[model samples]
Target: MQNNISHKQSNQAPLYLTNFISFPYQSSQQDIPVTQFMALSPFSVKWSSNGTGYKLYANSNPNPIYTGTGTSFDIPQGFKHNTTLMLEASNAAGKLYAFLTIIISKPTLTPDSITVAGTMDNPSILTVQGTLYAKSTLTINGTLNLGNNNSFNDITVGATSNIRGKATLAQLTANAIAGGASITTDANCALTLQPNATVNKLDTTSVTASGSSNIADLTVNGNITANKASITMMGSWNLIKQGSAFGEMTITAGTDGLVLVYIDPDNCDAGTNATAVITYNGQQYSVNGVNLYQVQSNNALKQGYCCVPVQKGTSWQCSGSTSGNGQSPTIYVYWIPFGADKSS
Candidate 1:
């Protein structure tokens, strides 16, 4: 008897596992990526997967630091430097791997005060948004920007120190200010220069002096408007009056004090033909040497010169006679103020 036994084969679907693993991230964190961690700070990495087993490895180590089925793992301690970690999830089908890079950062220190024994070069930056107080010398080799609406109580610069750019100050006290592009003062403000101060050049639109001011050797390239002016010169001549005929003329002195007047008569006939008499301060003075020049150009025209002392604002009178041709003599006056020239 030929017995043919046929074994029955079981038909079942192959086991397949779906991978729903997510990129590792810090627990309860938002807005920042999970690539950096502060040293000595404990944090947790969260993930999810559909696999039945999950393993986490740090820095590609063969042995896993965590082997569990949980969805999160807490790092024992933060890394000191940059590090890489890997997560592996496995089932009957195959294993799925995920990687992450964690950058380690130094912890922030918020001490009440920091005293550096030597130089600090590692950080190279210190930001102070508020007031900064330095009890000792604060030397800055770089640019110092005092932001808007900020001020410094006092700043003392050394000989070699240089301060550049525009600076606004309420009050500045210095022994000397040198090598500046310009200096400006507000309206109605007074810029006081000491007795020993020397200004190489001053260029401005207007300079008002309510009190007295003395300048030695001032050279002005523009107009000077003043209520009063006192000028002094040595061996210099000033032409006070010109192209004026000697007759019954009145002259008002333009000075503040007593002035000595010299009358120079030109184009006058010879020999007492032209006479000038001046009355000032209730005193009468006559113009002596009435004719000093000889006859010239076929005419008996000559010159006479005389000096008189008169006070300021005194209307001095000049009475003179005409020449032979009934023409008044042309006169030139020179004023020498006694206040300006002390020796006069």
Candidate 2:
């Protein structure tokens, strides 16, 4: 008896693959058959009496990689790198096929000195055991630290940047453009500012401005020892020109009978014939062995005259005919003219 199977009576429409995704990611040895991986065709056949079979053909190959009688078949190895495989399933009623791209390269690391640039999402982390370098700007939103004795070259911290740890560098350029930005050193460490650098404010134990500097305010917490200069208060003295005497005159009785007057050289011209009257009990006396009363007091009141009738560190004492203990007289002070020319 001869049996006939018609396509109209067949249950198979097309090969219904369980997973159409590419097979195993890695390939076995080059051009070698790798039978570990398998593909599945999960469809039912109407003519199961004839028994179903499967075949996998890789990349234009006419021969079947594996022919068997099941819904699944082992993936063939010996496939070239990145080749595609066509899986065919057939029975007495009908036959269908599905295409799957195969991957054949084992995972490998980055080649030496090759740079790869890509974005990392989902909060990924990259850990480097060796040195990492960024030729351009390196902006870290979080903290950055350097272990002890580690040094960085030519680092520039921005205006908003805050350096907390102790950073020791061969050379550093820090520009604090923002307000309230400052460089603070550790309590134990000493902060050294090089020559010609100007700082608005400084709070340290000791600061040595080797070069000229203008500081708004400097608060030193320790002793300030000046090696070469002295700190002086700010002020001066002016020459007060009141009046002048003209000739050999006896000091009359007035307010401050003996007035300690400032003989201004600007007003009292040279060669003026004037002498100081030094009389004790109506007897003429001399000062420092120089007869001032005879020397003509005009020359006595010149500039650089040590004994120009001025008291040292004390107010001038006046003893006139009307002066007495506890009852002093008020003698008027007047500029008597002894020279031909007189000044106010």
Candidate 3:
């Protein structure tokens, strides 16, 4: 875009444009933005030492893709989202030239923002650079330097969103978490696993606790007992889990009380609360207030008790003692039914 002339130039020597000006090349679909090229005609005539030079091409496929003579150049670092740049301005007897074309956006487009700031390195080793759908609420409180040492992707926490603080990765790809993040508090979350980091498609308000902890109530079936075993949530437990062809653990039943055994997912094997009514596969569930049930054949207090619609080869055995009083807290339904009876 140039159209300012002055007349007479018999062989170039008595002219003036010490530096006609132009330094524009900047864009961002939603990141890496800041293109400075707004000040031109600042008293011209320096045209890069006059020997003539100014080249910058993009996706133009000419062997010279992304070259710069130096008015300004920095819009080249993995650009992809609207790349269409072409600028050529010449001199040195080429007789004065100019041709501009720019299209690389994002200065301030407000619409549930995704234009994150730059300068990252502190436990941050990103990959899976695509597919992000956050209608709202997605923030991290700094520190992400995880340089070289990859294996991290599949971060889906949509449907009542949340992603707050401390993110370390080497493996955490469960790829399916959206039950309204339970009650969110991710309690000072921290990560440092690399054995392919193993499954984490979570939404039970993922809080890794550093001070005031609480990451309970959402394990009725999320599957991540990878056995490299490392579960820490600090006391107040309600670690709900369900998926039993067999194998489970929460031990130490003689110190104060904590013995819930049902070993079998083959041999590594893997609920609670009042009101009782049980039956799986044939469908019918309700467990309210004072309940405990293990099975081999015995569940005579049936009725659609409350809200137990969890099924899949059967799993729900909450251990005894609902704070004793008149005694009816003994529940043992360890599974073995079908043409059997225990003296009913």
Top lDDT model: 1
TM-score of each: 0.29, 0.26, 0.20
lDDT of 2 by residue, 10-86 (tens): 46444333333332334333233232232231111111223367676667889976677664443423343455666
Model 1, residue 268: distance off in Å is 4.9
Candidate 1: residue pairs that collide: none
Best by TM-score: 1
Regions of model 3 farther than 4 Å from truth:
1-9, 12-54, 57-79, 83-86, 89-91, 100-254, 257-344
Summarize candidate 1's per-residue lDDT along 1-344 as a digit string, tens digits.
01111222245322222222222235454323455567656656655556568787878578998899876777766665666767776655556666666766874444567788777554445667565665454555454545454333444443333436555443333434445345454544445543344334444344443334444324456775656765443333455444434456676765433333343444444443445566777877655324433556444434466666665566676664434443345555555653354222
Q: Rate residue 195 of model 3 by lDDT.
A: 31
What lDDT score belongs to each candidate, Candidate 1 first?
A: 0.52, 0.39, 0.32
* Deviation from native of the Cα of residue 147 in model 2, angstroms: 20
Task: Return the TM-score for candidate 2, rounded to 2 decimals.
Answer: 0.26
